[model samples]
Target: MAAKTVTIESKDYVFNTLKEAQNYYDAIVKELYNAKLTLTTGQDFEDLKWIYSTYCHYTKQNLDKLSNSDITGFKGISTVREKGGQYIPTECCAIIFSDSSSNCTEEEFFTDKALKEIAIKQNPR
Candidate 1:
């Protein structure tokens, strides 16, 4: 079957399947990381590179397993309508994160004084 073509914000692309869309998502993330590294310093670049590489490797490894059904999970349709006898999916917004985990304690969330004290104690420079 021929791939479906879609346009986003005036950009056009042909997606063979949902896997292609997933690959596009991963590519965008990698490119964003690369751009950030171009604007950052030694420690920040190294840390971001390590994080981006890990994510990219995992995404590429699982790319083949993605399908059309998975695409629905990535975006939510606000309304479905029949136009010219064809049903179209109208996306309201994309789902960016699935995990709702919080990494910081209530003290960290409420105040940065504790964090600053810890940093000063550790560095002392």
Candidate 2:
């Protein structure tokens, strides 16, 4: 048996010359590289969502109770909105990255204790 070779050609090729085809191929390669560069992992995505929600809640509460100057002085704050909404703070990142200065704030610790006490009184536990 003899080896056979076949060649295929498009009569109406969009790119008339090999250089044009190469240019198109190069453009597609660049686009693919750029797209890959922008991808993020699932865990990173979820953490971002949680950070956004927490920041939104804190910013809303803090801003409502303080003046603009006072609000700006605090770090790691951004615009706050209902759980699902569109709004971005002009001057802050939508996430906070910090450690607790205390294990829990004085007010929150007492409030949590009070709630636990009430729960215990309601049902013996």
Candidate 3:
């Protein structure tokens, strides 16, 4: 198949054709390739992968916190209205991904910690 032959223009650079744009990017990558991996041995690569994985997980959580309806926004904790019309905190552990957008019990998480917080919230002294 023939490649697109249209010219591409960005801020200050104009690429005559798709191949030219690709070659331009390829050249930039080649120029920086050695510098990017010069100090990275197998162990260094593994460490970077580990750190990147953690970074992705951490950022996803933080981003979730910024949203009102994200599970991590409340750390998978929620509330349920009981038969008596009273409400109770519920923990979903790692199952739910987005916040239910309902009220979550105050600072209640893990069972023990959550129970304490629930008690404190219910009967503050």
TM-score versus the correct structure, for each prediction: 0.22, 0.20, 0.24
Q: Which stretches of candidate 3 lie over 4 Å from their true place?
A: 1-10, 37-125
lDDT of 1: 0.31
Positional deviation of 4 in candidate 1, in angstroms? 8.0
Locate the minimum summed-lDDT window of 10 residues in model 2. 104-113
lDDT of 3 by residue, 36-82 (tens): 32222343233222322333343354344434542222123334535
- Of 1 and 2, the candidate ahead on TM-score is 1
The candidate scoring highest on lDDT is 3
Cα lDDT, model 3, residue 91: 32
In candidate 1, list every pair of residues with a backbone clash. Answer: none
Question: Sorted by lDDT, highest first, which candidate order results?
Answer: 3, 1, 2
In model 2, what lDDT does residue 61 have? 41
Q: 116, model 3: CA deviation in Å?
A: 57
In candidate 2, how many Å is residue 114 off?
Answer: 74
Question: In what order do the candidates fall by TM-score, top score first?
Answer: 3, 1, 2
Model 1, 1-125: lDDT tens digits are: 43333222112333344344444544433454344322133432333233333333434532332221121112222345467999985322222222224221110010112223322333344
The candidate maximizing TM-score is: 3
- Lowest summed lDDT across 10 adjacent residues in model 3 is found at 106-115
Measured with C-alpha atoms, the lDDT of residue 58 in candidate 1 is 35
lDDT of 1 at 63: 33
